[model samples]
Target: MSDLRQAARAAGTGGNGARRRPAFIITIDVEEDDAWSGSATVATRNAAFLPRFQALCDRYGLPPTYLVDWTMATSPAFQEFGRAVLERGRGEIGMHLHAWTTPPILPLTGADHRHKPFLTDYPEHVMAAKVTTATRVLEDTFQIAPVSHRAGRWMLDETYARILVEHGYLADCSVTPHISWRGTSGAPGGRGPKDYTGFPEKPYFVDPEALHRAGGSPLLEVPMTIAVRRYGAVVERARALLSRSGPARRASGRLWPATTWMRPNGRNRRDMIELARRALHSGRDHVEFMLHSSELMPGGSPYFRTFRSVEALYDDIEALFAFASGPFEGLTLSGYRARFAADAGRPPESAAGPRRTG
Candidate 1:
């Protein structure tokens, strides 16, 4: 292990043979309901699930970070719920930019504009403008400057890192660890980013020159906890072989049981606990749990299409929290950032090495 990893492990465990405490974070992508479908419209949005989500947080004492997109930020109902959460001191508001719905909506001119809304595919200036608009709206609506951001579709790059830093964001949770959205076929009209197949699963400072690489960058990249099992290499090989064939890839996805990621509604108690154990053992101090607020409402999301499914999702979350009670302490995104800053002896905003200039 690297010195940084070793030091982090030692600090987490105290290195005195005492058991180490695991740390976990819950992050919700607060956005419109039409996320899966490319039909992102202002009129088809809802924030009705916020109350139930807040109640769940209160029940578990989990202070989650709600990464609100432009639609959610602009919705009066969502704003009211966000205000309630803030007033109750149970959550933090962060920025989540859905480039398509965000302001400065450019005219559909090319494949990039017509297809999926990958922020990196847009011009750096356009991306910056969208980010600026979204950030300003979120800050204005919540009455607090957002310190963290997560790009829609996990489509972040070095330009995004620079923009985030320019906007005073301290952390980003857009990287879904152990997985890549690159070259993956999206809905009939969309395209994803280029390959990020070898990105690290652990949280680290983004390398400014190569956003996929880990290094000393001002922004902390907190990837979602997506652990692959022992057959990860096999799964990768199969995936690569079937990359060009959609049907084959779909078949492989169904047959691949070893490729597991921790999702509230998708992962079982055993898988989540095992993933958490592996993360803690690998010297990781935090395991991030992510979900969409739309999933909390029946029919709001495909994952939870019914009230029963929503209750079941909650059951899964409750089970994971209960299982983690002994080893993991739940924290909000801002709370984790504060703790990380205290441990690093400086703020994340000042932790980057010299910026690369061309």
Candidate 2:
């Protein structure tokens, strides 16, 4: 343990605590109907996915985190839904602010959010106000202070770091390693590699400048894990082409060849499980997987529709748990983060046994 502490210090972790083994952290970004770029069924599926997902978590004695958008908070049904998650005890509620839907800050007139880009885009001043309001709403509605966050459309900037800190958000999971998003507005840059940059794959503190230099802010930037390989683009393009042929072909889940569909960056259900398995096997158990709430519903993804109905989503949750309990232990973000912090500098425990990475 002492030797492990020295290694962690050399690795720039600062404190001398043992490092925990790889673990699982599942984060569901609770989004609003308005924030979605395409269809509205995403939110409806999210409403379905949550309870069933939570039920699966409960059965396995694992807790999952839900980052709720402020827009979703307005619906009585959704509000009740959020409370229901908290009641489950295996759930953690966090803010999912959509700046556009959120009102502008007080005492700062003319700060309209209409032209601020995404519905979740909030300029600095307005962002502060929105965070405060959203935090209060989550507390009042669900009676729990959110501990983590993810930006709407994965859109965020340096200013958001300060905003999150002020609002008591311990960690932010918006960055996806080696992946960038391009749209009419512009291309979103990535934070790049962690090993070279001295960033930890597991959650750890970063300077606001390093965070911003990485193109964001200084906080515990817990990036979402993405499976990347040389054939990624080829597979994606072929799937897109097949999906475009007709709704029937896409609906059949036969759009992409099975081999191509399971390749890196493929949208198959097994691809997701592979990513989770890789994180667990790396002895860096801090795995955080994310998808827009809409991704869980039918008509959500053009290339892949894993869940055709609410029951399908439940089945996925069950499959995920079956794997986790059998191969690796699971923990919520807060639980994972706290354990990592406490065990900093210590070597990870022994791997239970060798397992396939993908």
- Identify the leading candidate in terms of TM-score: 1
Per residue, candidate 2 scores C-alpha lDDT tens digits across 97-117 of 665555443322232232224
What is the lDDT, from 0 to 100, of the residue 121 in candidate 2?
A: 38
- Could you tally the backbone clashes for each prediction? 1, 15
lDDT of 1 by residue, 67-183 (tens): 998888888888888898898888889999877778788744343223556676567888888888888887777788788888888878788888887787778898875666655
Model 1: weakest 10-residue lDDT segment is: 349-358
* C-alpha lDDT (0 to 100) for residue 144 of candidate 2: 68
TM-score of 1: 0.83
- Judge candidate 1 at residue 144 and give its lDDT: 84
